[model samples]
Target: MAANNITSTHPAFFLLMGIPGLEHLHLWMSIPFCLAYTLALLGNCTLLFIIQADAALHEPMYLFLAMLATIDLVLSSSTLPKMLALFWFKDQEINFYACLVQMFFLHSFSIMESAVLLAMAFDRYVAICKPLHYTTVLTGSLITKIGMAAVARAVTLMTPLPFLLRRFHYCRGPAIAHCYCEHMAVVRLACGDTRFNNIYGIAVAMFIVVLDLLFVILSYIFILREVLQLTSQEARYKAFGTCVSHIGAILAFYTPVVISSVMHRVARRAAPHVHVLFANFYMLFPPMVNPIIYGVKTKQIRERVLGLILRKDV
Candidate 1:
């Protein structure tokens, strides 16, 4: 058994030590988070069902949208359930191994989501900017190849994180201050040197997230140029409108991550709580809003989903 006399030397210890007014707020916060999780699950599942059932949505864009929905389901479910349990049920204790496992999946899925967004951006670019060969360019086999490559790239980039985390010796503190397992939080518990983990984490973040953002931006730039060259104002408006949902989804996913990263470095005492809240929002908000975005923007998917619900009622 690990010693129970261990104490945390993390910089945020004082803030987490039963702060006034904030100590018991977890219960209340869990209510909204639970609602968000429920909505995310239902919304993403509905999107998936609509995509699978509607034969008209068998194009590359819808296929990528379905893939995004699937990723959102896995991504949100990874942390929200345990977070809700911790908050609502007062079950805050977690085994070290379980915490590490949770961190692994959380990071892995986040990277995968970033890759999927990049793929979606590329798909849009090809459709709008290279309409002459859109079908030949984004065939089923090509989409499969892109999906496989994204998965492989995410796995390869994240594979080292767990191993690096395992190198540290934890100080036997089982109660994490935040609602969910985070990479920096877990690593801070280590009694050993953590410089390597910090460096590696930053490197992976730059490679997967920063690089992916660059690619997405470039894709959109070309897409915008192509749209401007179109002679028909109606066609240009339609093409630009089709991209609004995707742009919103990307902003929803990446903005919180950027904010959380900055908060982690500058506001050590408050980062854990803010990070947890925003992390939950970042993971679930996209999933919850994505289906609605697509439904409002894509006529065929909206019609098919509504038709299916109406038929079931009849």
Candidate 2:
């Protein structure tokens, strides 16, 4: 049955875009990716469990953390399994609809992650810069509304991508050279001009990602200024300490994305595999490290997670 499905659909490289000289090691190369996938799932799941079970963590910051973990799980799941299948089972063929679905979820979760980061930044800004109004500004209702807005923003931004993709007629050699159905790789297969898609993608990215990053930076700037104004050394330490985890997470998430974009454009030949590896890192690294960041930075979550682990061991 599966063989029939493979034969019926045109064999476009849905995810596993093989590198030029590294095709031979594709299977072996996947070992690190397998490890990454496992660690991401386990770590993010642990974070999710800690947030859910701990009543003290029912605040807006942990709520955003939980949402981020969920987004990471979905984002990683959308790409990694297909890449693993291609590497291990030699099943590189994916139907057009399946590819579209993958692209949608991948992009959606990515946008959502960016939005969540922005929300987290806002949370920090309120808590640090406006401690007096933090309770009023970041109410549970407001957080729920922000979460909805994030989802809506993701959906609205990604709505046009699939429609644009559907208009294109793919040409021969539909092999995608990456590990997953990335926007650039899939669009490159179009026989028709993709200038519009590229333009719109850039516009959307600028609006969503760049704008969110700017907000995060501005929020931190305000936070830092407020922290500096505090006379008490203990108070200053407390203010700075709250943001350490968030700052670390933001760097881990965005730095790889910026690096990947530059690498993709400058080095076209090796870009596919490099792109795949870094893209995976962009999604997985944040999730895997987020728990550690929180554990090291947040006293409540750290103690709860440790207590839970020790209880299980006992």
Candidate 3:
């Protein structure tokens, strides 16, 4: 037990932390966390089901909505289950390979989510700006290709990441600071120089998520310009209304991350729990809120979900 106090020079397995200083609050913390996870699973699943089951929703917008829901599900599952295990069962021991696997899935799916959002922005741009060519621009075949390309891009970018970690010497003990196996968190545990991992990780993240954000911003700029050019107030309102849900999703997906990043800088001296709250939000909030953002904001999805519930009760 005394020897265990010394940090390992080469940790074979990683121990994930729940909420470091707030271990006593882990159970209480898990209530909201479990609720968020459950909602994420149920909401995304329901959105997918609603989108797929309703033949009335076979448009490009709704199809893209389905893609977002799928990405949200994949992204949430990558971290939440393992996180819940840590919080509840206290099963923190993860083999080195498994941690690598989780890291890959988490990063890959996050990139995929960004890519999908970019594709959706393109979908909206083509739809609202060039309605005449909307059908031609975003056919079912094109949508399939976009989905495949997004997945391929993420996989290709992430393939080298785990291998990069394999070369490092993790002198620090197995305990990871966060509930999940984040690229930075895992890399930070390494004793050897990790400049390459740091550089590659930051570069890939910026290239993927940041580039997608830039494109999304450009798309919205074009969208807003197009909406403003509409001849009638009603037309302008209608055009902009279609984009409200997408904007909500964009905000939900990105805000927590930006907030967490800001918190990192501004709250360095703050309590660990403050960081833990943001970290959990960064991981959990988007998936939990995306479906709600889409479902409640998109009239079609909202009506369909309500109709389904009514029919089930009847």
Residue-pair clashes per candidate, as listed? 0, 3, 0
Error of 3 at 81 (Å): 1.6
**Alpha carbon lDDT of each predicted model:** 0.78, 0.81, 0.85
| TM-score for each candidate, following the candidate numbering | 0.89, 0.91, 0.93
User: At residue 268, what lDDT does model 3 achieve?
Assistant: 85
How accurate locally is residue 264 in candidate 3, as Cα lDDT from 0 to 100? 76
Instruction: Return whichever of 1 and 3 wins on lDDT.
Output: 3
Worst 10 residues of 3 by lDDT: 1-10
Candidate 3 C-alpha lDDT tens digits along 131-198: 99999889999999999999999999999988888767677778888888888888888876689888
- Of 2 and 3, which scores higher on lDDT? 3
lDDT of 3 at 73: 85
Per-residue lDDT tens digits for candidate 2, residues 147-229, read: 99999999998888878887666664677776677787787777657899999887887787689999999999898899999
> Which lDDT tens digits does candidate 1 get at residues 67-128?
89998898888888877776666666666567667777888888888988999999899889
Better candidate number, 1 or 2, judged by lDDT: 2
